[model samples]
Target: MIVQFKDVKDLTSSPAKSEKIHVYKSGENKGKTRKLNAKPARTGILPVSEKTVWTWVREGKFPKPFKMNGRTVWRLSDVETWIAEQESKATILKEGA
Candidate 1:
């Protein structure tokens, strides 16, 4: 499922640390439910390196990170949505070809 950024931002704007975010899993665990984290776990899921992630963020291909207690964190939902979008585009291209 693709999580909207506005929804994520609204949820994070509050002081509720216990609030859990829903993220869609891919691969063997596809369609499974998972708890979201603000930690940088993009590389584990995405095929790109840490530097590429930062580059994508700078180029507007990726979502901008949120600041949490002096630590830069990305909403897991946003990352998942971005990944889904990329995969969808790839599928479209392959189909067209």
Candidate 2:
């Protein structure tokens, strides 16, 4: 006869954070951590062409997408921040830049 026991600490421990989870956890979500499955972002909510997205990324005007399993993807938070930045920059340019 044999007895097996599981480590009790393992049951109480927090799950390890993935990159997406970490980003959401680091005060990025108004201090709320979102699910890791939260959709990655597209430049336009209306299906933007790849060239536009890549152009901003290349120009350092957009958050660089991450390589995931051979596919490039950007986090929702990053894309949102980039959009806000672009809007602000556009306003500043119109004013004087």
Candidate 3:
């Protein structure tokens, strides 16, 4: 028989600091806090560190982030597409192996 287990530390870890609570300052939901859905490109959507994200960008492995209102950001669609492509590639490699 064979069994698999995830790292206990990983299971017990809290959400990353990148996941932040956003407070509505002036909208109808003013004073209400919501989990931020969009994260800055510097922090990256993946579990990787900020430096890794920049390194990927420099290496041309990741999409380039753009400045919007002086804040750097990546398009959600682009990020989603990149993730899908990575998944497909992984599937291909697994099948080939």
Residue runs of model 2 more than 4 Å from their true location after superposition: 1-43, 46-48
lDDT tens digits by residue: candidate 2, 1-97:
4432222121122324444653344544666654565443323342444565567669986667666676556666555566688789899999994
The C-alpha stretches of model 1 lying farther than 4 A from their native spots are 1-43
Sort order, TM-score high to low: 1, 3, 2
Q: What is the lDDT of residue 48 in candidate 3?
A: 64
**Is 1 or 2 the stronger prediction by TM-score?**
1
CA lDDT of every candidate: 0.64, 0.52, 0.64
Clashes of each: 0, 0, 0
Poorly placed runs, candidate 3 (over 4 Å):
1-44
- RMSD (Å) per prediction: 15.4, 20.5, 15.2
Candidate 2 — what's its lDDT? 0.52
TM-score of 1: 0.55
lDDT (C-alpha) at residue 47 in model 1: 54
TM-score of 2: 0.44
Sort the predicted structures by lDDT, highest score first: 1, 3, 2
